[model samples]
Target: MPEAGEVAARVAERLGTMRGAPVSVESARQLPAGASRATYAATLVDAAGVPEPIIIRAVPAAEDDGGLGAEAEVLRAAADAGVPVPEILDVGLGDDSVLGFPYLAMNFIGGESIPRRILRDDTYAAARGRFVEQCGGILARVHRIDATQTPGLDELVDPVEALHALFPREFDAMPAGLVLATQWLVANPPPSSPGSCVVHGDFRLGNLLVDADGVAAVLDWELVHIGDPVEDLGWLCAKAWRFGGATPVAGMGERASLLDAYAEVAGWRPTEEALRWWELYATVKWGLICAVQANRHLDGIERSVELAAIGRRSAEQEFDALLDLGVVSPEVVPDPLGVEATVPDEEPHGSPSSFELLDALAGFLRSDSVTAEMSPQVRFHTRVAGNVVDVVRRQVLLGATHAAESAQRLAALGVADQRALCDALRSGELDGTDEKVRAAIAADVRARLLVANPKYFAVPHP
Candidate 1:
């Protein structure tokens, strides 16, 4: 919660102590790194007028579960095992130390972590061509790190059980899709690991910084843990991480190319079915994660329009999991929000109604006049704000109809609500494989997308 200037000043003092020399801050600013933490890019000027750039990564003391010191150790282990990573300069674990939070300082590595530029910009065209092979090689190296030697690293739990606990907690109740996916995962476990090794819990385009040549350095070590090496590959290929790319491997290359490169480096390749099982598990994991993010706003942890909008995206992941498990497909029903209905000139509120004002706000937020001069973080938030406004507008238009339909479908299945329906799935009274259950799930997902993101329906299946 400190100001940017204050954070920069602490960095100067911290690095000064590390080097046993005077250091002064030249400049510092926050980067739009991740949803839950703060990352600062800072420059320090020595008394001799030499300049040095570094990265300061901080998590709130309340949220630093795996001590930042442990993360720093993992980074060193990763680098020693041939993985490209930023050099860790120092770490602070005490609340009163440095910036008054758990944090780490590292030498800065320059590259683009934004998927929009890396996937679309001409500057990274060559990177796009080689991302698959390079990512595979990097991930293989990541899995080679010896977790036993790494201090404070969390031993992997049963991933499916972890997700099962998370799902109902985040949503306040489980859905039929969750029960279906859980049963599928339990009944169809993947092959045992080659041996327990490191898994980068989140290894996708957002964390891989790519320069013109290729991946410059791997960033974000907070999620590193001891787990099956295949977890990294599955997390990478999750549909939710594709970020609008056409291909499956972080939108950069084909699945086969990634597996081939990984096989060449690791001396083995997982069966396609094994990979698919892991991928499905990851899809379910991401869905609940989106809900957890939304709750960060709803529960007042970090209120932001961005998180609220992302809450709706959990439905898309649920939809994807069902499609993967052969429980449902993208139904081609006409979008209800696309209706060409005329509005009454004299509305209940006024001449220019509440809906009209919402539309005006959305348009203004999206207008270049408003966002052209904003910082990258502000600009991204502005876009999300605009999308969130549209979601509100569409919900106002169709929420009641969607609610009625959901209730009717639940009643038809002899359940009182979604919660009861989920209970039925568990008791074997209602089958996930039944056509009626699939129909209800598909309809619920379609309504959600109609409000959250209508275009998601058009994203070709990988």
Candidate 2:
């Protein structure tokens, strides 16, 4: 694989060769780092002309990110269907040549992400409302796109099936509790929708580009699938994406307005029950997705505080889902996984493991060197390392208690064992056929979270 430097060199060479003049790299900036992909800000200038800035996104070849070509196809299809997006200049499916990573380049939409920064402002709040309106209008247009034209559209898995297929693999390497939760979710598939549209698997604020007026570009199509449109709305309104947590609505606008705008475009309103159901499902789905990344960190695919910090947010999401389901009253939601039963005040037996030692070392490095002399990026990584230690320590302290409770709860439901319970949960063996089983699983999960992190239970009030 080409290193970032090697890739940059290739980018410079490619621009120079294309423009027929020597091109200099004016600037290159890596955007907010994440586990799934890397993004870069690139500006190039040729001797014959002016500078042009472009955004470059690179993903691992193995990911093949079913979303890539599918997303490009969706954007193209949406454009024809009348939704707005950035002009795609080019997309590259890597072959160990070009850049050693599957890459896509698009004209950098000139705007900040449509987020609270705009939603909180008096001048921008009105625009924010319009922005949500635009999102609904745009999504309705996206839904109108002919799925047959989008590659892999027919292969798109329904929400339940997709979750069943991906969750085990995603959380396979994580703690047993996550695996258990994944099983329970798969087992309890909701009422399936006959309406399959080109769904933006990740339609949320952070993925959008916005100017002072409205959405300039809808970004991140990696998870785009031909599934239920309500999935998009649910995902958008999901709590995790509601950064700062004040926006009761998706991306900080009212959900009703967003839905009403969609009705305006589509000629029919999506049922509130359907939307709410999808929203609850999306919450668990996203939380499970985050759990996978947390596992990656635990497994050493990457050590990052941001990823571990994000792992903590999953409990918060579970609380939101519980509230949405009406299984728990908003004011009475319990503490996470009985955290009081976990998180110890003393060290464990025997010699500290390498992770623990590295954690200690990272802390020392943070205080003595990182905080004092390192660049922001280096400091950020140091904090990530520290956070990883925190997450691991917390899990080690709390996990066994939750796992034991989970096993007991599953057994009480007549599940022979954890694996059997997981299999039953994934195979639809416990849907309408097993209401008591589902209730038991939900109760156990709630109790586990209460024991794990209670502060997360309090949903942010507007």
Candidate 3:
């Protein structure tokens, strides 16, 4: 993370060059909540003494973010198509003299991006009711953008193929359910759409800014590409994006309402079969992404508690895929184990126990670290850290038993370990119809979810 002073200085220098006159940066601060890129809000005064609020999005120097300039172009094209998007103020600032990293700047638009708030807060109740239709219309407009107009934008030839190309290591580390879903997708491909257009690679509630009127603007165009327009529709309806709500469309409205709204504007509605295929694809895509995010942290590319937590969430997506594919019943719960509790041996004990130490750290972060003195970004990260500690605490208590049970289940399946079981499932060596395979995978996912997030099993899916 860049210091606020460094960000301010860079913004000042960049503004001076853009305006061809001296410019002053009043403040620059990091914004919370983006996972892929770093965003900074900067207030600057131009030579005319006019103050401006601008957002600068920069790719971390350590990561290969291939599309900052392309994202800017896509934003412009979306705006030209009458889609609500932030105005792109500047682009192509790759030189170290400007920002020390490639960045794009845009006029800041205000609205709420948090899904929990958007879904349950009474302030947004009206917006929640109308957001689905609004998003449907906006997505229709975005999909209408001419692919030829955006010459350099990448095309998603095959989403499944694209996902396979992501991890060249043969996916040995992924969850069995995800591997199974990928194989299923390969065997049962969706009928190709006759033509292609711009598809918002990620169009979900968190990426949308909602206000009382409806969706204020579509944000995060980094994944923008040319593909079947229905990809966006299916992504929007994905269960993972639903955020625990029973309703499919962003957890706000019915799938029929979304489809109806899209048909009203786009002149065609996708068949239920096509939508199901894409929805399944969305589940697989999200599961793979969760795995990749976890790998980023585990591999030391980015050390983040949030990323590590997201890695565990791959199980949630896998369970979702199984539910969608009819491999597991939606009501399937983790089977209770009957292991006898073992008493701890006499302590050659030291200061604080591991559990106590983690408890203390989590309590400190939650109680002291999240004060007003801390920036929102810092506070957010502190909370995430606290949550991570809590997860570790749970793992310390339950992980061993969970691992033993998982191993026993895999051994019963004639597979030595998770990797082998996943490989077997992927290669179609294990019959999907076999009750033993289904039960074992379900129980395994249940055990994993119990360690990762017990709340998932507590809440019923819609």
Q: Pick the candidate with the highest lDDT.
A: 1
Model 1 residue runs over 4 Å out of place are 61-67, 165-168, 328-339, 342-348
Q: What TM-score do all the candidates reach, one by one?
A: 0.94, 0.77, 0.92
Q: After superposition, how far is residue 185 of candidate 2 from its true place, in Å?
A: 8.5
Model 1, residue 80: displacement in angstroms?
0.7
Supply the TM-score for candidate 2.
0.77
On a 0 to 100 scale, what is the lDDT of residue 34 in model 2?
46
Better of 1 and 2 by lDDT: 1
The lowest-lDDT stretch of 10 consecutive residues in candidate 3 is 335-344
lDDT of 1 by residue, 188-258 (tens): 89988678788888898788899999999998877778877888898898878788777788888788888
Highest-scoring model, TM-score = 1
Residue-wise C-alpha lDDT for candidate 3, range 278-387, written one tens digit per residue: 88898888877887877778888777777877877887888888887777656544422223434223277765767668778887888863566887887887788876
Q: Cα deviation of 93 in candidate 1 (Å)?
A: 1.1
**Backbone clashes in model 3, listed as residue pairs:** none
Model 2, 1-462: lDDT tens digits are 234455555777766676677877777767654466777777877786687788877775345642466666777777788777766656667463367557776667787764666656675655675777888887888788888778666445555556757777654433323444444455555556557788778888778877778787778877777787778877777776776556645546767887898899988777666776677677778777777777676777766666666666566655565555444454555433233542344445545754456557657856865578865556666666665555555565656776787778777766766567666655556442355664665566565455445555565633
